[model samples]
Structure formats: structure tokens, C-alpha cells
Target: MNVKGIHHLSAMTGGITVNYQFYTEVLGMRLIKKTVNQDDTSVYHLFYGDERGNAGTELTFFDFPGIRQNQKGVSSISGTSLHVRNDAALAYWIERFTEHDVTHSPVIPYAGRNVIFFEDPEGQELALVSDETNSGVPGGTPWEHSPVPAQYGIIGLGPVKLTVRKPESTLAALRLMGFTEKSRIPALVAGQEDIIIMQVAEGGSGGEVQVEPRDDLAIARLGKGGVHHVAFRIEDEEELLAWIEVLNREGLQNSGFVDRYYFRSLYFREPNGILFELATDGPGFDTDEPFETLGESLALPRFLEHQRESIEDHLRPLVTKRD
Candidate 1:
């Protein structure tokens, strides 16, 4: 099975209104899709990305009301990063974060690239990594109308940091999925040993994963600000189906196949208990809505269209419009 690269990262949030404002206005991302979680239609599943919510550019959130803050530790997707054009974009973000009162760290190098770590109001661990040196997996185009200039706007998902307790098992799983060890880098988080960096096909910032073995920390508890799962991009349904058989042949259990409407998916937990998903990149966010006003109103998959009234009634009005 040939995995393309990072598909999208989904996370949890406690407050939808604040989250929407921060991502769209503060970070200058486009709300490419406004939909509800399919499993539980009461809460919203907001998708923020570039102009079209391309697979690699998506950073989505599920607003589960009253969820507690994320408990940081091991066996988790510790951090998610976004790709900016170059080092100069880092400076623009620092200034923008400061202006908007977004808590952030100074510029620093991690995994051979300059990045600035920052947190949303909900304490979501995130970073903006410069793609000045990238040569592999190309980045998506930024929304032309974003408040942040196109050069400074986030273009795509960058290398994701996965902190797990059992590095060998996770490493083996990754290798089975076509990733190879790239190199080792110092752990970005203090008190941890060197991190093992791995990359899949045409690896670069977009196609890499940083694996940190942290036996010293406790297992992370799921809550607001915690990442739900990180997905790897698959070229098409055929590739996805072939992978299912590969995983089954190896005796590794997995979600046979799930149609997520926008994209098909196969989910499973690695040895360390971190959820991993393999999702197709096609049938994108534009499948249901018009290209002009993608996220202007609530959008339901055809399957859920019948229950839209009840779904809308349970959801509180989330104001995303700017004056």
C-alpha cells in the first residue's frame, strides 16, 4: 500500500464560536466546510482549510460541549503543524499572533525546519513550520481572500509529531504502511530523548512524521484540544482496498472501509493505542457545496439531509461572520 502523505488532522474543541473566530479571523484560515459530526449530529464538525479544503490543507475540529482541557502526556498526537511559504512567513505569524493575543513561542528549529509553536485559546498544540527547504509533496494553494497575505498564509499540513510509549510497534506499523526512517532529531518537548523522524513516498515536511518515545509520561486523556486522529492520504479507493487486505494478511485489525461522504476512510489503532486513519484525497469538500460559498451555511451529507431540521435545532447558533 502506497501512502501519499498527511491527509488531515481532526481535533476536539469545547467552544465552537471561539474556535471559529480564532481559526478564521485570528489565524486567517478559510472555513471551507460547516457540517456536523456524522455519528452524533447534535454537535458541529467544523472544517478549516485553504480555498477548497484540500485533503492536505484540512484542519478540522469537533465541538463537544463542556469537554475538559487535553491532558498532555505520551501515546498521543502531541502536536500538529501547518506549512508556511518560508522563514519570512514565520515572522509575519509571530507578529500576527501577538496582535491577536494568540499565545506563541519564539522561532525555533525542529526536525530540520524553522517553526513557531503556538496554542489556540483551548490549548491545542500547534505549530507553523516553514517550507522554504521542502522539495517533496507540494503544498496546496492558500485562500486568496484570507486576511493574512497569501505568502504568509498557511498552505498545507506539515510534519506531525506523534509521541508514543512503544516506538517499535508504531515504527513497524508505519513501515508496513510504506514509511522509512529518515533521521533522528532532538525531541522538541523537554525531558524526552531524541525523536525518530520517518517519511513516506516523496517525503518532505508534508510527508513526514516525528516519532518521540516518551516512557516517562502518563497516557494522554482525550478532551478538548486533543487531536482525534491523524490520517494519511491514499490516492484512491483501489489503493485503500488493497491496504485493507494487507493489514488483514498481517493480522492487524482495521476498520474494513467507511464512507465518510467527502472521502472514504479506514480506521485503526496502532500498537500504542493512537488512532490512525487512511483516507482517500478525492470527493473533496467541494463535492456537496458550491465553490463560491463553501462554508457560508450548514452543509449536510445526502445521507443526513433528511434530519437536517433536527440537527439544526439541537445546535446553537455559531456566529462566524465578521463585521
Candidate 2:
């Protein structure tokens, strides 16, 4: 079974309010879902994405108030890159960042694209890569309520950068999941490590994964602003189960099968310690609410419906302007 591309990239956050404002007001992504972590209902789970909350466009967060800042190093997802239409889109973002006082780096060239690096309120490394070649999935819909116009809004997730001590095992696991090496690039900055690019069978901008060797750096600690896990897309339950079997046969320990309500999931860790997940593409964000009114109110799965009262009472309420 071939893993298609990124389903969503989930990270940890310390302040939900600040995160909400930064992502919605500054980044211009739609707040697609406002729910609680299924494993830990006391905290909020926020999802931001393009219109319809499509598979490749999602960037989610788990709010853990008072959580310590993450220790960055090897064995972590260091950065997430979002795709922009072209150079003009990159320029638009630079201007927008300036107006909002967002911290950003000047546009630089890497991997045959112009990239502008930035950070969120909590310091999650992020970048906007100019996919001038229009190399992303076709027919991606932009959020209509986004402050940024649809023409320049992010197309989808671009190459995600992962820091690893060694690439052998990680590359092996990825190969089993249907990813093929695309290319490699030497480090542009002094003291930085070289990078290897991996792409799915249906290769494109969003389908790429960039791995940087950081063997000399210390291992990363999970905390606010660090990625919790990176999820890859599977077609449906059938593909999900097939992958579970494949992983089991390959002696890879994984979370058997998890019913996430919206989509089923399977969790595992690569040899380098970066958490990975295979998530189905169907029964998405709209499963709990209509597309027109997504992220409007607290949503709970059927099993958690009995605790909705307490869940809502324990968590702070969120109001999305466009919801």
C-alpha cells in the first residue's frame, strides 16, 4: 500500500488564544475544527487548514497551557513549510509579516525555490516556499474568509524538515511506506547539515519530505511548539489496515488501529524517534459539522458525548470570527 502524502502535521502549543489569533489573523488559515484531544479531553485540539480542511492542508495543535518550551535538536520535526503560488505570493507574505510585526527571514533560495522563514507566537519554525512551478495538487481550495485573497493563500503543506541522527533506518521505514528519494542538497548555512528530499509516488510540492542529518545535535524533548507527530495519508480503512499488517510483518511496533472519529489512525515511531502516523483521508473535519459552520462550537465524538458538559466546562471557550 502506498502512502499518498501528508494528512496533517500536529504540534503542541502553550497558549490556544495566541495560537488562534496568529494562525487565523496572521497566517490566514481557516480554523477548521475546535475539539478536545481524544486522549486528554481537558485540553483543546485546534485544526487550521485551507477550505474544506483537505488532507494536505491541515496543521493542527494540542493546547497544553503552561507547558514548557520544546528543546530543539535531532529526532524532531524542525520546520514545516507551506506552499505559496509564486514570487508575488512570497512578496505579499513578506509585506503582511511586516505589517503584523511577525518575525521572519528575508526570502532565500533552497532546493530550487524561494523560501521565507518565520515563527509563530510560540516559536514553531515555519516557512513559506514559493512553488512557482505550480507543483502542488491541483484544485486545492483556499479559505474564502481568509484575510489574504484566495489567489495568494497557501496552496498546501510544502516539504517538512526532519532532523535525524542517521538516515538509514528512517529512510528504510519511509521506503516501506512508499516514499522514494527525490534529491539531496548540501547545507547552505555554515555548521548546518546536508539534506535529503523524499517524495511520495505521486510526487509534488506537498508530497516532499526533507531530512537533515543532525547526528551531532542533542535529541529533542517534546514540549510546547514542538511537533508531536507527522501524519501520512491513506486512502481509507482498507489501506489503513493493509499498512498495519505490513508494519507488523516488518516488526515495527505500532498502535494497532485507532478510531479518531473523523479518520482512523495508526501510530508508530521511526528509528530516529520522530513520531509518525498513518491517517485515512475520508470522514474528515466535516464529519462532525457542516462545512459552512465548522469550528463554530466545541465538538465531541459519540463516545465522548457523555462528557461534553465537563469537557466544555474545563476548557476555555473559543470563538472564530468566521465560524
Candidate 3:
């Protein structure tokens, strides 16, 4: 089965309010869903994306207040790259970042594309890549209330960078899951080895994954402001289950099949220890609420409905900042 592209990338956050403010007010993404982690309902599971909360556009956060800062090193998803329209869009983001006092690096070239590196309030690494030639997936809609104009708004997720102790075993696992090695690029960061770019069928922004060898670094500890898992898009349940079969056949352990309400998911860690997930794209954010009122209120899956009151009381109230 062909994995289409990125489904969504989920990360951990130290402060939900700060995360909400930066992603919504500063970055101009819509808070498309306000829900709690299904496995552990005390913490918030916030989903931010385009107006419709499309698959490739979603960037989710699991709020764990007062959690220890993640120790950055090998065996973790080090950064997430977002695609922009072109150089003009990159300039717009630079200006906006300056205006908001968000710390960011100067535009840098990697793999022949111009990119600006930055971090979220909680220190999750992020980048904006300019790819004028590539038009993203069809039917993506921009958030109406976004401060950034639609033309220059972030198109979707770009390649996710993973810091691994070694690339050989990880590359083998990725190939088993249908990723093809594209090219090897010089490391943009000091002290790191070369970067290997891989992609699914004819990859675009959300379809690419970068593997960076960082054997000298320490093993990463999962905590606040660290990536939990990188989810790649599958067409539907059929494709999702097929991947489970493939993983099992190859003797790789996976989460079997998990129904995440918005999407069905199967999760497993690559040989280097970076978590990966395969997620379906349908029954999306609009399942519980209409497109017009998405993210307007706290939403819970049917199983959690019984504890809605308790969950609401546990989570701090979040309000979107709109112009």
C-alpha cells in the first residue's frame, strides 16, 4: 500500500496556554480541536491545523504541565519542517517572527531548498521551507481568522528530521514500509553527520523524512517540548491494517490497531527508537462538529463522554485569540 504523506505530527508541550497562544495567535494556525489525550485524559490533546484540520496540515500537542524538559540527542524526532509558498512567504514569516519576538535562525540552504529554523515557545524545533514549485495536496483550506494571509500561510508539514544513532537499521525499516531513499545532503547543523532524505511515491513536503546520524549524542528522554511520534498518512482502514500485517510479518512490534476517533492508527518504533505511526485520513475533525464550529468547544469521543465534566474540570480552559 502507498503511504500518501504525513498524517499529523504529535509533540509534547509544557504549557498548553503558551502553546495555544503561539500556534494560534502568532503562527496563525487554527485550533481545530480541543480534546484530551484518550489514553490519559488529564492532559489536553490539542490539534492545530488549517481551517478544515486536513490530514497533512495537523500538528498536535499533548499538554503535560510541569514535565521535565526533554534531553535532546539521538533516537528522537528532532524537528518538524513546514512548507511555504516561496521565498516571498519565507520573508513574510521572518518579518512576522521578528514582530512577535520569536527566536529564529537566518535563512539557510539545505538539500537545495531555502529554510528558516525556529522553535515553539516550549522549544520544539521547527522549520519553514520554501518550495514554490510544489503545490500541496488538493482541497486544503486556510483558516479564515489567521493573521497570515492565505497566499503565504503555511501550506503543510514538510520533512520530519530524526536524530538516530545509526541509519542502517532505520533505513531498512523505512524501506520495508515503502519509503525510497532520495538523496544524501550535508548536515546543516554543526557536529552532525550527513542527512539522508527519504520519501514515499514522488514525495513532496509532507512526504519526506530526513535521517540524521548522531551517534555521539546521548539517548533522548521523552518529556516536554519533544516529539512523541511522527505519523504518516494512509488512505483508509484497509491500508492501515495492511501495514500492520507487513510489520508483523517482518517481526516488528506495533500497536496492533487503535481507533483515534479522527483516524485509525498503528504505532511502532523504528530500530533507532524514533516512534512512527501510520494513520488513516478520513472521519476527520468534522466528525464531531461542523466545519464552521470546529475547535469552538471541548470535544470528547463517545467513550469519554461519561467523564466529560471531570475532564473539563481537569483541563484549564483555553480561548483562541482572534483579530
> Best candidate per lDDT, number?
1
Considering summed lDDT, which 10 consecutive residues are worst modelled in model 2? Answer: 132-141
lDDT of 1 at 67: 94
For every model shown, what is its TM-score relative to the native structure?
A: 0.97, 0.97, 0.96
What tens-digit string does per-residue lDDT give for candidate 1 at 117-231?
A: 9999999989999988887888888888888999899998999989988898999989988999999987655887789999998999889998999978899998999999999
lDDT of 2: 0.87
Which stretches in model 2 have alpha-carbon errors above 4 Å?
A: 134-136, 188-193, 321-323
Q: Model 1, which residues run further than 4 Å from truth?
A: 188-191, 321-323
TM-score between candidate 2 and the true structure: 0.97
Cα displacement (Å) at residue 46, model 3: 0.4
Error of 3 at 151 (Å): 0.9
lDDT of candidates 1 onward, in order:
0.91, 0.87, 0.85
Worst 10 residues of 3 by lDDT: 132-141
